[model samples]
Target: MSDNLKVVENATCTFCGCVCDDMNLTVDVDEHRITKAENACILGKAWFREHGIEQRPFALIDGHEATTEAGVEEAAQILARARFPMIYGLSDTTCEAQRVAVGLADMLGGTIDTTTSVCHGPSGIAFQGVGESTASLGELKNRADMIVFWGGNPAEAHPRLFSRYAVTPKGMYIPNGRKDRTIVLVDVRRTASTPAADIFVQVKPRSDFEVLWALRALVKGRKVDPSIERRTGVSLAVLEDLVARMKRCNYGAFLFGMGLTMNRGRHFNSAALLALATDLNQFTHWVAKPVRGHGNVTGADNVVSWQTGFPFGVNFSRGYPRFNPGEFTTVDVLARGDADAALIIASDPASNFPKPAIEHLKRIPVIVLDPKATLTSRLARVAFTTATYGINVTGTVYRMDDVALTLRPAFPSPYPSDEQVLTAIRDRVRVLLGGNRLPAGAAPIAPAVAAAS
Candidate 1:
């Protein structure tokens, strides 16, 4: 890669829901680096800052350095012999990689779950209860005259969301960006992004579901006493105004965040939003999109759903994919100490998992495959550092809207890409299975490189 020869490939930022596209890259082929980026949000810049890697590949065996091949073999042996195994963490890689991972898990009669099971499992449950109406980012950008930010701050969590697509930016039909869109903020506390909104609705913590339901009732043209106002902290008049605006808009969009899903109501909150969006469609067009946190969390859902006819929290212990969010989720399985071993790829669970799960991890052996020194890596029995996906390798990742996009590398490195590492693991797993029935296979997975190369 040279500065003069740097090519910026058109793609979406995989970091968050506002998948901003049209990013520019200045790669120096001669220098083997990404020198600059254009049109990416602040978080996107941080995502690309550690472009190429310099760390040599090695593994930890019994808390000691060893070859990655030895580690993989040891991991394979443990997983193969264990009565129950869990394969988790698929929220930061390509859909292709996620597919291969789930296939191996199914063949081994293990559980395959994603971070969503812990972060947005409730939302998924709610989705199953009441289906949602959704629109493409392009549609929202072009036609949505009213946009609401509920329980999220895109400026920090999804840095370039407003400037790239949702609130502030101009689109094909939106000649004037900020002026054309009406912005509303709903949160428990005020943040940097909320202050800039045209309307800010402050609600009590963990009362998102109650507040939303009340608003939905108001949207349906129902009258309520002041007690409803006392409960939601928003006057009935204010709720009526939001309903009126939503009904008047040609197209209305709601960009929801983890706050709704993580609070007391959990999945019901998601159900309410979906139901509310559906309700709004009775008079005017309305839709909602989850403000996802991980780069490939959406990809995990897409891959699993397409492969095994189910989404996250899929169990394969019975040699067939079974969907059960509450039982098969990573937290539930680990908390019960059902998993004897684990193979975590592309995420850091040690920092995010609950106390019980972390305690269990300390007692069990873990195999970690990632590009950085994360909390998960620190505790793993075997850790292998591979090439960074967007910088040293290229692959396909799905956007928040289920739009698949290609991520191209701008620099070169000695480390093999994620594809190579994944293919290696699959081959090793195949050898361990020896013609076992696999459920996640979509293609004849060839080895990308020698397992320990």
Candidate 2:
């Protein structure tokens, strides 16, 4: 043990959607890195240990080093002069920064989208069609006796989810912890999570909607063909047993992942699953939630929905916020060459987007704000290195369960926070667009931005 080591207790890990906040990080102040992370999972330990101050410029303009102020000025000018600019990527950032971003979109009258458009966008659409029956992680921990994981492997993706919250933890009602719960895994094939489940239901690929539909029918006491087992790759006996367990449980929860949302049926698949959860309420308490990927992505959806009326793929070009997925989504807009400029925050779209979308992003004048140099930042005309939230900066982040937690920064960064940088850009854009005045009947910016702060 070094005499100069600093221990930060109860630090939060934003590596995944779990948002585990009970880590005790041992920081080497002289080395400017975390030496140890107590009470952290493998992923959380790696996340805390790998994050440190990088030797990169504070800002870059056209790949050249420049002052942060110059980068903000150029970014504002590029956004102001563009015909149809777009803002994307708020999933990894804080809620305060997300709100300012929505205000910036309104000020520029541009389209604003989030990573949700790709990951759980279909789930959001399904939520709108068939409202969600969700509960907090605490509720599931304490009361849920039957837990189902549909189309997601929390073992590899969210390492701490089972041991910390769902499976192995001792809760108020679940005193025996893992012994008190019945874990069911529903996926197309066997995964690491399969070994953890008491029952693993392997369905045919792309047959999630059919399986969910059959389950709903069985729950409703309606006649489902026994041949459904051949269609969905699950035996009728197995389906009946699963439904019996679900109906007889004290509390049951369905936590689905992109497997259901990004499949062939997409939103329809999610809708059917949610509708099944709704149907299960007739016999027992049941809830469903999307297992989000990013730590603050749920916060992004919440903030965007609060500021604009929509969750993602929002267009403000008509002097009001409009909700349309394919038309206004980042990938669609960029692939169609509709946007002339873009502002990306805390996301790397160039590496993951479609070829056409990546090509269009390269052609446009792009601005990025991220803690590290990412593929999107490399292609940006103006890139500002911002502080990492939940580590070097403090703000509000939402868990996958929509529980809001305040961030406690373990260390400081030389770079500015995303909220500070976005606020500066917003102020500059407002000045450029004539002193906070917006088009007739548009949402007011001052009030919304202030409320977010």
Candidate 3:
């Protein structure tokens, strides 16, 4: 142990959606790196250990090193000149940065989308169609006695979810912790998380909609033939028993994942599950929430929804905000070659998007802002190396349950934060567009401008 080490107590880990805020990080100030992360899981430890100030250029333009000022100027010019520009990837950043990005998109009259479009976009759609029954993670931890995991393997993805909040933790009502709670795992196949379940129901591939539909029927006291086992691979007896447990439990929760959203039925599958939770409230308390993947993705959704009146895949091209998923979403717009330029922040779409979207992105003038170099930054026309949130930068990030937590930086960074850089670009774009038309607090569009358009 070095005498010069600095320990930051109760620091937040932004590696995953868990956003565990009880981390104790020991920083080697001389080396500008985190040496120890106590009370962190395997993923959180790796996240804290792997991040530090890297020896990279502050900014780049056309693959050539340049000053941060030059990069911001070029990025502003590119975005201002494009007819149909797009802004994407606000998942990994802070809520402050996401708000600036949304305001920038409004200023440029460009489309703005988040990484949520690819992950839980369907869940958002379903939520809009049929409202969700959700509760805070704290409430579930202290009250829930029956927890069901659907289409998600939290053991591998969210390692601390069970130990810290859901399965093993002792609740007020569940004094016996894991013994008092009933755990149910539903998935297309058995996974690493199967071991944590008292009952694991493996369904046929792409049969989530069928299984969920049958469960809904059973919960509603409707007739469901036993032969449904042939279609979904889950016997009707098990579904009936599951429904009985859901109705009997004092508090129940459904923590679903991408397995239900990205499949064949998409939002319909999510709607069925949510509808079942609503139905279960007649007999007992039940809630459903999508197990988010990114640490700040839920923040992105909240910021965008409040700012633009939509969750993801929003467009401001009509001089006002508009919502349409397939049309304005990042992948769909890129795949269709509609966007002439792009401004990406804190995400890598090159490695994550489809072939058609990647091809179009390569052909366009793309700008990226991230703490580290990524596949998207490699092809960017302008890129800014910003300070990492929850590490070298301080801001507010939303937990998976939409609870905002203030970040405590372990150490300072040499580079600027995303909020500072985006604010500069936005100011430059406002000047280039000819006036201070849309100020920080004003509506996205001026009243007369929106009326005229």
Query: What is the TM-score of each predicted model, taking all chains together?
Result: 0.92, 0.95, 0.96
**Stretch of 10 with least lDDT, candidate 1:** 437-446
Give lDDT: candidate 1, residue 429. 71
Name the candidate that leads on lDDT: 3
Q: Which tens-of-lDDT digit does each residue in 1-453 have in candidate 2?
A: 356789899888888899998989998876668899999888888888878888889899999999899999999999988778999999988999999999999888888999999999999999999998999999888988999999999999998889888888878999999999999999998998999999999999999999999999999999889999889899889999999999999999998999998899999999999999999999999999999998899999999998888999998886888899999999999999999999999999999999999999999999999998999999999999998898888899999998999988878888999999999999999889986435546555544646746
TM-score of candidate 2 relative to the true fold: 0.95
When 1 and 3 are scored with lDDT, the better candidate is: 3
Q: How far in Å is the alpha carbon of 245 misplaced in model 3?
A: 1.0
What is the TM-score (0 to 1) of candidate 3?
Answer: 0.96
Q: What is the lDDT of residue 373 in candidate 2?
A: 90
> Per-residue lDDT of 261-330 in model 1, one digit per residue for the tens?
8888888988898899999999999999887778778888889888888779898876677898768888
Writing each residue's lDDT as its tens digit, candidate 3 over 1-453 gives: 356799999999998889999999999987889999999988999999989889989899999999889999999999889888999999999999999999999888899999999988999999999998999887788999999999999998998989988999987877889998999999988898999999999999899999999998998899999889999899989998998899999999999999998899989988989998998999999999999999899999999999978999998877678899899999999999999999999999999899999999999999999999999999999999999999998999999999999999999999999999999999999889875334324455446846656
Kindly report which residue stretches of model 3 are placed more than 4 angstroms away from their true locations once superposed: 436-453
Deviation from native of the Cα of residue 384 in model 3, angstroms: 1.1
Write out the backbone clash pairs for model 3. Answer: none
lDDT of 1 at 155: 75
Q: Which scores greater on lDDT, model 2 or model 3?
A: 3
Model 1: residue 333 alpha-carbon error in angstroms:
1.1
